[model samples]
Target chain A: MPTMFEKIWNRHRVLEREDGQTLLYVDRHLLHDGTAPAFEMLRARGAKLRAPDRAFATPDHYMPTDTRRVAEIANPELREMVASLTRNAAQEGFTLFGLDDARQGIVHVVGPEQGISQPGMLIVCGDSHTSTHGALGALAFGIGMTEVAHVLATQCLWQRKPRAMRITLEGRLGPGVTAKDMILHIIARIGTAGATGHVIEYAGPAVRALSMEARLTLCNMSIEAGARAGMVAPDETTFAYLQGRPYAPADWDRAVEGWRALRSDDDAVFDAEVTLDAAEIAPTVTWGTSPQEAIAVDGLVPDPAAEPDAARRAELTAMLDYMALHPGQALEGLAVDRVFIGSCTNGRLEDLRAAAAIAQGRRVADGLRAWVVPGSAPVKRAAEEEGLHRIFLDAGFEWREAGCSMCLGTNGEIGAPGERIAATSNRNFRGRQGPGVRTHLMSPAMAAAAAVTGRITDIRTL
Target chain B: MERFRPVRSIAVPFARDNIDTDQILPARFLHLPRDADHGACLFRDLRGAPDFPLDRPQWQGARIALGGRNFACGSSRENAVWAMHGHGFRAVIAPSFGDIFAQNGLKNGLLPVRLPEATVAAMIARAEAEPSAELTVDLQAQQVIDADGVAHPFEIDPFARRCLLEGIDELAFTLSHEEEIAAFERRIGRENS
Candidate 1:
């Protein structure tokens, strides 16, 4: 019985070496601003892109969220990174979504929004969040710069197959407990390294009921759990989402016929299995540096002394010290200095809708800064057309241009040192937002609620 | 890629779990050219701290590192490996590593040696107790010779081992099979259309 992963893996197999590494052909290669080094490597060895038609480029990592003009990027070095992608894309014959293009956005967000990511395809990017494409039933994972060069030269990569894990979510999620909460809850239960060396397939009733956008959010954080990739089998919901997008196949019906068969067999066996109760999951939030150190919004901070293992106890103490949180402190009612509601993880139209619903009548708390950066240019236009931007602007939130903003702060959109922020973006690592910045990760709705109250307010309470 | 050679040097122990790529090389310096010396940027944020291990003079110029579980756990930035290599680290001994980081390390000629958690913990203890204690990481032998003279074996993919040992360029090797790739592409084109 072949699982969905095995079927896709077999389809892309070019050849296998004696060392158990198989060379898999990449169907779609997504590139971003951070890939200048890869192009440099290709040039160093006098190599040309083997499959330019299969590649797409965009400026994301180094793009300034404040403006779209290349000249206004402030830093000459950062401006060159964005310009380099355009230059490389033109020099080679690949499609480029430049800063001025309406389709331009975060590479991960641009992929699915434009329908370049589809069912049963093998996709790759230089960013770890490339796993976000697996929501469409693709076998996608991140690669390093060297692998990026190898893929450019050969359109294939050598890979050791990872074991498959099936995480089945049973029951139904409660109100205000979104897909972001579901994933945060999952990572909290299984520590960051829990799914190391495994590709996870999310299944069961709760997964099937999620919308395409929600599924993308669920899979986006798969890297946080150390999974090679995360996937959900393509179904009617997936077909509907990809039906008429820009890059959907011309032979749509034929493509659907093939995509319909992309699923695990009835007797498919997984190397590991985990079951989560959807009803038990709450609107979750991270109180510490790691995503695993999360708890229910109404819960208290974990005390390191309760951890019997010395190593774990020390890690907890360090995390607490960095976060400036104390043992047994309540997560609710903690003051926030900033609130950010956007990223590839939760920057879709649906996410903005959820946030707008909460900010319709409420003003942001005084002395606090809040921003709503849409994920893509398309998402920004859609939100504006629906008057969601007005809701956020009226609520005292800055409506910014699309690109990765404040997620990793690479483009200089960072919090002041020691500022505590409620963020809908992934990763709460120390200095992720800036040196000495404290980030508490939560769902968009929860973050919106926190913004209006000037504290970490549970969405359900609002 | 530089050919990997066996290394024997004092091991610096930073026994923190989940030391992400951000800590190894912060995102700020990611735009620096590939040829730049990244050694100074290694642990750039944590370097000046009083108790930080790398700041200790005794472990200066250490070529081997002992780390806790899930070392280099986040981000796929190859710069992290470059930072480690630039800082004169030839090998890292850890219980586990981020999948992409391990791959990046092997491709860049920096060995990532996975040992048992307890074994790594013991090595960290020994390294901390005796700063002069040196360990040898023999890739060809597939063993990590601890300071106690105990030889602990490790596993690595044979293909990776051969490449690292011979300084093989993977792109060149893959390009040599141009005929097979073209044939496969033609077949896929027919099937899709």
Candidate 2:
């Protein structure tokens, strides 16, 4: 009766303390530019990486999307962060995807693309979006800098086993409703803390029907819902995606044999179970600062006065004020100042294709700033080969290089203060893109639709 | 890491839910060194505004914070914990927290206490109404004593509680078990082969 999570947890268990905290052996440790502090900790402790071969490093968070030259990063401090990762990787023996490398991208996108993340592996990174790797059926989660140091020193982490939750999506999703919309809908229904202290296993027909890229997008935002991790059991679709990737197991048949057994038992019990109708999901967008304040594209912004709880009413009022949104304001036709279509959450090749399809014959609204930054250099190259860049460029959307551009605005890629943005990345927190910047999170197609109309227009209507 | 001792100090109430790490320490300041004074960056953007809670004279130098549900929700940046600890907050009382942030807090000797929603709300109200109200949090006893002298019990992982109480360095402790870790690795290597 063990679920997929239990199976992976058991396999990784090295030892359990009397208080029930288990030391789980990590199979893969991904690092990014922000990991300089962890390396510094290792230096301070006079320690060396226990398993260098199991770790990989890349520079993304601080990378400039406009240039490949590290010196062109502008800020000396940010340049050092990117350079430190390269320096640390050379000092310690581990693979480093440097700025000019075609393989360099957001760590989440690069992991799946390179096949470093596999079914049943215990993968970890210092970034919260590490949950994105669970799309490959791995027990992946994010860690802090201290935990990153622990993993670097010992290749293990102490974790209290989180309870298992299964979220089942039934029926086929309606056209124009993507995985981004589905996850946003789920977070809105259950609230941000709905899955706290639990790892979510997505199952049922709709989950199985998603492409690997779509599944990655869905799992990428699991952290946004307060879930420790999110997973979809490996199946034919997963096998097909990883078949010829760089790091796929050499003994393909044997690996597939083991992966086929990675699902939960038919009668397995879960700590909690939730079901969502996929057909009911629509192209959704956040109306407030928090991700939980999402509604259907056709819906109006909610009025805070209608909320009964005093605290909740206050929160809604504050969020509305920060977003510059009015009570009961129509989400559609709300003018947007910027449109960003990239990030680990929605910067995959398929995501770019979705956006390109919407931008094929349409021109971006006059005076609107729109950009399509590919998730990785490989994604950029592939999109260029397919003429997707030409389509975006023809439609007046700036075609930029890879890296996490405008997602967290850490790379000097932020909208102006008080600019309302239609973003395909995760998180709509206050001042996330920039100080006083109002962000509306949505799917790539919806973001593209907004770019064309210069407002928050529903993709279906476009 | 310093040993987590009992803290009795005036509490600051944020009176908001889902206050994310970005608000605690903006992404722009993430590249700063760990030793930098992060206290100055705490709620940097939100501060200086009219009636910002952290800027209020009564809440200055508070060592404890009372917040609503899902406090420190987004991002896995441990710097958020550092910002709070650097700002003289020894303990935070909330109904829930982001998993990564809570773990980061324990490793840094900043105690994260989970109390009932209503109980926390009452404490927040009390702290806000009475600026001089002080709350005591005793890790060893696993209880929070409010200004009214009512002790509300809370639960934390036993292992985490012990580590915080003794100020144990987790990396050092893990490294001490090197032999067993190697043995376990060999066994897994054999099993996979």
Candidate 3:
């Protein structure tokens, strides 16, 4: 009754120390601007990359998303930083998706889209959202810069095995609730640090029923819950998603056979298990700084004094203060100044489609700036081909190229001070959108609904 | 690569919970060179307030920071730790820390001391009461010495403790096993061949 995580982990183990640490071979290393330091460290040390073939590079985090020329990078230091990444990737012989490359996008999004993230693989990235690749049945997680350099110098990393936790999503989702909502609801049920020191494998009828993009979205935010990683077992759905992608194995049938074998035993046991009824979940929104400070659209902002734990109550008080929210106030119709429908968490094609479906033949509310950024260049091309871009543009939303824009305020995309934004991004941390900018995390469709109404509104009602 | 040694320094208390990396060193300032003076940017949004501990004259040149639970609780950006280090902080005492932040802190030679919530709260209260009071964190003995001469024992992973005391950076330690790693790779390569 071994869990799928254990099975994959056991296969990748190279050496085990007496202290219970294992040296596991990493199959792929996804790199982006956040990891430029690793290359700099390697260069400073005069060390050569040990396994360049296993590494992939891109600069999604630092690049301007609006087709600004590289020379127009206003900050000279940032321009140098982006240029050094391209130069280092070329010198190191790692496959790179520079800004001009058609394949350029967020590393987490591009990896799965290009089939570089596959089942039974051990993937690591410098970015915390690396857990998104686990939807393909891979054991993936974010590593710090030290680990990134270690992986670059050696295709292996030292890891203490994490305890297994199973989060089962039972039954079908209710109407208008999405994978984003389900994850938000889960984080709310379990506080931000609830899943610390564990690797979670999401299972059950509801999880298996989700599309590949939705499953990726579910795993993407696992870090927010403090889990080292989150994964879904590969099935026919996973195989079909990987079949024709650029980097998929040429021997497709054989690859599927191997992937078919990747599953937990029928009676697999976990150290902890939590079950959620999909029908109970709603279109969720965060009311406070942390992702866990969330509630359903119809729910009220929590009163901190009612909280039993003094520490949590204090945290809640701080969140309520920073978010400028009052106790017992209804969350619906809270005015928003901006709406961002992008991020590795919700910038995939399906995510854009959900937003476009709500935006089609509608106009954005006056004084609200709504922007739609596709997850990858391919996702951008596909959305344009299907006129999803036209729908968003027609609705008065700014349709932009692919990059991690506004999800983080770096790269010249920041909200003004005190501006409140309805965001489809993963984090709702205080000032995450911009300094003094309040963020309400929601699904893309919900963000779209808010964009059209200029306030937080339930997509179901719309 | 400086080896951690015993230090007794005044502790500046900032008791905010879940002070995420965004607040530690906002993404806007991360574009500056790593060696750029991030001390000015540390808590840039909250620094100017007279009530803020770091802005107070009594806490100037303090080498310790006391905070509430889940300190440094967001992104794996090492800049948060670097900024604190740049501000001359050697240790951050908290009830808890984000896992990634703790790891990054250890890598950067900054100590992230985890203590029980009440104990940390008491320490913070003491620091606030006596701004000139010094706390001595003994890495070798694994204890935090408070103003009342009480020693609070803290636990650390044995391996991490060794790394800090010996100044053994991750790269040097990882490269030490190069032969073993190369041999293992060769063995696997042969099997595939």
Candidate 4:
């Protein structure tokens, strides 16, 4: 028997050329400013967009949401990239949620909220976090600008069939454990590249128990574990989550019936299976370079000298040198200069709530520049309504507008080079935070903790 | 302007898995418009260091890429596929692949093949032991035959397999069957049908 992923990939496999690849029709294409310029070139050449109606775009990167600092966007290069998004969106006829639109947010968040993401649909976005929409039971994957152009030009994409991998999280999560912890734990065990080249279909008891938001977080990090995409088979939990959202179809009973059938069959075969015991997952924080080079909150820093492989030594050594940390120095008590809590990874409204819940009435450490940016305008609004923003602001943290602020230092929202920051976004590759900036990846809750303590501290404690 | 293909069988081993399109060609390289040779950037960010075993004198002229599952993890960037094709890689061997990579690979006449983990592990172990070792991916047989004559049957989507066998991408195949596709479209175009 085939899994849901296989069924979808095969169902859309329209034409098989002699090369043995299938032409699959793309249902929806989502893109952002950071990955939209090349598509603009196609328009210049007079190539008609293959499926213009199926694509939607938004301006996330390089869109300075902070009104106060808008004037500080002095760099002319970044300014042009921001305008290119609005310009291309206008010229290409894509439905664009530009910066002044109330609906504008991160493309991933906007897709689901707008009901554009649905079960059994094949969705492609230029951004990596496109996996977030899989919470609606859609087959979503991140595409590149070139592929984005191809999809834009042809409305169809050529894709090869993939073997299925299932990651099963058994048992229930412990108190204070979140989907963020579950993925971090997976990366820790498997290393960063454990599930490379496979579609990770999340399964098991713990996964079934997670909320749609939590499931999105899990799939969101599927990239972290080296999986091409991570998804959960839609179930009652999925249906319940999509019931009354702004875009989920009404007459939910009918929707639920379709969703119920989205599960893999009993005898379905998978290429690989990785099991995670959810109870063992603790709050995760990355002290080293990659999202995979992470440890639990209670874990100690990794010792580079003890590393077995030369490659491991180099990676660990590079991270140590860049971050300017010594081996055997505890991850705790490592002072931070800044804390950032936003990204497609963990900038959701609930993520802010989780952070604010811990930050209520607590003040950020003196001299620490802590900030929170929601993933979408809607998330920002929701956080304000829930007083999550107020909690963050009251704690002396900067409450800023949405867009990928401080995530990549795009839009002039940056950490001064060499500043140590506890960031909540995915990827801590060398120079990923900013030129010469050191970023330690952590959960939103952990970032909040770091802000309050000015150091890497366990969220469970604070 | 066209992607290069190996005359015979070649094996290129990329050790990294889940290499998103972004990493294949960094955002810096993305500044160059598409169709400008972005091939050199393929696997550029994933170098295994000067002394790493996988970073070999042997990996210099190989074609078959033995990779981990979810080999292409992030971004929907077509450059990932463009980079792979430009890198002279005709086939990718892994336990699995990213949906977009699989799609993009097939689109550009590159084979993204998935085998059982046990089979993939054996292939990886062999390639690591002898970086120069070549693996034969017989699309007709659907088997990855390593240099030592070890053969392992790998599963592929029949459609994708057909495209690779015929050297055509998905779009070309669809255009070839335009009449049938048109009829099917007309039949299903009605909402109430």
Candidate 5:
């Protein structure tokens, strides 16, 4: 018996090179503005996409989240980048969710939302977060522009088989602990590079019980753990989610029958295994520049002197200096200048509802800024229909349009230099949110709590 | 892409771990036109800070880079690799790399060498202390000759090694077997339809 990863990998193996690398066929190719360069590279080489129908492009990364006309874009480079993607998509004849498309969103979010990503399929994209698609039981991975060009030229990629690892979660999640917390806890236990060279299969009761959207959030950060991809078995939960998606098959019963066969064998073996008790997990937050530097929201900041690893101790010292913090200090009353509750990581409808629940009666603190950018237009429309936007607005939070806003510092939204932010997006690296801006990673509810209190407070305690 | 072979050049020591792609080339600069030279944007943010290692006069014109584990971590933007290559870096010696960055380097003719953690650390320290420090990385020999006359072995996928040595990009390599790929696509398309 083989693991689900192995089964999928074996099925997609197209050609085995003499040097041990295998050329795997790609079923779905997701593209974005970042892929514009690959398209240009292909054009320069006089190449054409092998199967344009299999490829989909969307202009999301560089697009502005604010309601701005094309003429109002201040950055000429951003305008050109967006224009280039539009030009290339039209030239290449690939389906694109342009700026006006209702489906427009982050590539990872749109892929699953529209059902372009399917169970038992191989998906590749130029963006690293493409692993989000693996929640549907697909073997999905990210590739660089060079590899993107290769895939476009020929719908196949040369890859070395990654080892298999299984992480099982038992027990049940406590109140205030979300899927984001589970992933943060995992990264904290196993440093950021813990699972390098392996594809992880999340099994056991805790994972199987997660909704498809939650599973997508878990798999979205697999790359942060240095894993090639993360996946969960496609069961009834997955089938139900995909049942009415736009790109999903019309024959729902037949589609489910195929998806049901995409699970790992009962006796499947993995190269490595880890088990975690979900009961002990708490609302988590990152205290340093790296994802692995996370601790419970109520936990004290680490004391560098207590660190045994000399290199890590120095790194921690530098991190503390950069974050303007000290050892043994609790993050509880740490003042925050801003709060952001969106990104592909936590911008889904459920995430919005969780934050809205906390903000229903509370108002954002004076002198603090907050923004909630939905994951996609559909997510935005759904949130508005449910009056999630009104709840946030009434609570003094600014509800913005959909895009990767404030998550990466590339867009118009940014934190001022030397300011601290409580963000629900992934990554807290130096200047990740903007130059000299410190970002603290948390869940949507935690970020909402921070917005209302103007500090990093435990959501459960709120 | 240029062909890879054995050569010796000055090495810039950036001992930091987890040097993510965002730091390599920030997203703010990613929107630059394709015609723009990526080397100009390499470490643009870090270069502005006075203490960044790349600002040291010692590393001026260095053709090789030395860093710790998980170098080029995060994001699949190939520009990270191109930025290094554009800045005259022919090879990056690290304990580990983000998978996509390493693959991107291979096709772009930038050699990514993975040596033991201890060996990489020692090499970086030596390179930093001696500005004129140079290393000869021989693909054929599968070893990097240190300034002190010690040869440190490194590992690379055999297929990638052959491609780099032959100056064969993935596009060229894949196109060589166009007939077979086309046949396979036709078969799959027919079955699915």
Candidate 6:
């Protein structure tokens, strides 16, 4: 009996390298502006890109679709990186989705929606969020720019086999309980470092009930748990999503056959197993320095003293200082200065709809700056067609263009020094948003409510 | 295939938890072309920051590093490892590592040691107190024998531990496993038929 990860990894295993590493032939390589400079070095060395068609590059990291100067950023270096990626992709004869091109969006979002991400494939990107592609039942993970260059030159990377783990959720989720909450609940159970060196395979009824969009949101946060990647097996739901997809086979018979074989056998073994009750999951929000420091929406701020571990105390204290939050304070009434609902993590149409619903008859609170940047042009168009943008804008939210805006502060969309924002972006580490800015992670809907009320308010109650 | 020379290097204080690749090399420098040899920029802003260890005067020029757990936490950019190696670090001593960064370190010949955080902290403190101190990191002995003869044992994955102890990087190790893998493949093929 074979697991999906095992099947994909085994199939991609080309030659074992001497160092106990498998020289895996990557099935797909997705590149963006921030990661292309390193590969551009290969051209400097006169080494041509080996597998042109197997690779793809796009300019999205620094693309600000809101501004007319999309091609030219204020930052000269970022501008060079975007231009270099566009040129390299062109010279290499690979698909280059430049700014102004409809395909120009987040690499992970663009890949799946464009039908480039397929099941049973091994995908690599230079972005940590590449794990988002595992929604297609692929083994995808982020690689470094050095490895990125090597991949462009050789179409392969040396990888060691990782242990497999399964996280099965039982029962049904309560109202407003989302895939974000599910993943957050799982992280809280496992801690930040729990999945340090494994590839997780999510299973069971709750996951099966999730749409492909929700599943992608779950896998996108695998990095927050310290996992190499996260995946879900394809079934009818997965095949149905891929039916008219640009890259999925058009023939229904072939799609059914492919989807049927995407599952793992019942007897397939996993290195570890964790079971969660879907009914127990609440609207989760994280506090402290790490994602694992999550608590229920109704829970109070964590007391580092209750942490028990000495090492955790110092870490918690550090976070307390950075965030300027005192111990034992309830997370509910904490005032937020900004709210950002964008990034590849939760910038889909469903995410926008969820946020828009909360903001429809509401307005952003005084002194709170709120913005909504869609993940892709298609997502933006779809949201606009549904008046989701109008709902957001009328609600005092600045509905903008598509890109990974306000995420990692790659573009100029960052927080003012010391200002705090409840962001839908994945990471909340100190200065992750800017030189001295703070980010509090939340669901897009939650972020919208936070923007409206200027505090951490439960979306369900709103 | 390579033209770099073996430069004798010393380890500075090790960065701990969530020491992202961006911190090692900021996102700003990421645009300088993949092979741009930006190792000099490793921990640039971090070192320049008033709070970073490198900003401290006493610990300057110390070789052999020690750190807390989860070093190099975020992205799997191999440039992070290369930047450290390029930054005159021969080895990094920590309790644990970001799994990807650890592999990247070994693949690129930046020796990563796994030790108790307390032991690593003690070593770092000792180096800070004595700038001329040299902590003899014997991979073969799996020990960081201090100048004062205080020895602390470290833990490592058996395979990665073996590779480093033998001073053999991943490439050499993969070459040695080729014969065994070929044999296993042949056996599996015959059995399947």
Chain B alone: TM-score in each candidate?
Answer: 0.98, 0.97, 0.93, 0.79, 0.93, 0.74
Clashes of each: 0, 0, 0, 49, 0, 12
> Residue A84 of candidate 6: its Cα lDDT?
73
TM-score of each: 0.99, 0.99, 0.96, 0.80, 0.98, 0.89
Q: Flag regions of model 1 displaced more than 4 Å.
A: none
Writing each residue's lDDT as its tens digit, candidate 3 over B1-193 gives 5898887999999887777888888888877766789877899887886667887989998999999877887687777888898988888999888877887888887999999989999888888889999999998999999987899999876777788899887677768888888887788677545
Best by DockQ: 2
lDDT of 6 by residue, A351-374 (tens): 999899899898899988999988
Which stretches in model 6 have alpha-carbon errors above 4 Å? A68-72, A250-252, B1-18, B32-51, B107-109, B116-132, B138-143, B148-193
For candidate 3, the docking band is medium
- What residue pairs are clashing in model 2? none
Q: Show the colliding residue pairs in model 1.
A: none
lDDT of 4 by residue, A129-181 (tens): 77777766778877655466666766666655656888899999987778887
Q: Tens digits of per-residue lDDT for model 1 on B1-193?
A: 7788889999999989999998999888999999898988999989988778997999998999899888998799999999999999999999999999999999998999999999999899998899999999999999999878899999999989999999997888889888888989999999987
For model 1, residues A1-462, the per-residue Cα lDDT tens digits are 999999999999999889999999999999999999999999999999999999998888888798999999999999889889989998988999998899999888999999999999999999999999999999999999999999999999999999999999999999989999999999999889989999999999999999999999999999999999999999999999999999999999999999999999989999999999999999999999888888999999989889999988999999999999898899999999999999999999999999999999999999999999999999999999999999999999999999888999888889999999999998998898888899999999999999999999989988
Tens digits of lDDT, candidate 2, A29-65 = 9999999999999999999999999998888899889
Tell me candidate 2's interface RMSD: 0.8
Runs in model 5 with CA error above 4 Å?
Answer: B48-51
Write one digit per residue (lDDT tens) for candidate 5, span B55-154. Answer: 6887888888998899988888888887898888888999999888888898888899999999999998898788798899999788999998899888
Runs of candidate 2 with Cα error greater than 4 angstroms are none
Cα shift from native, residue A136, model 6 (Å): 1.4
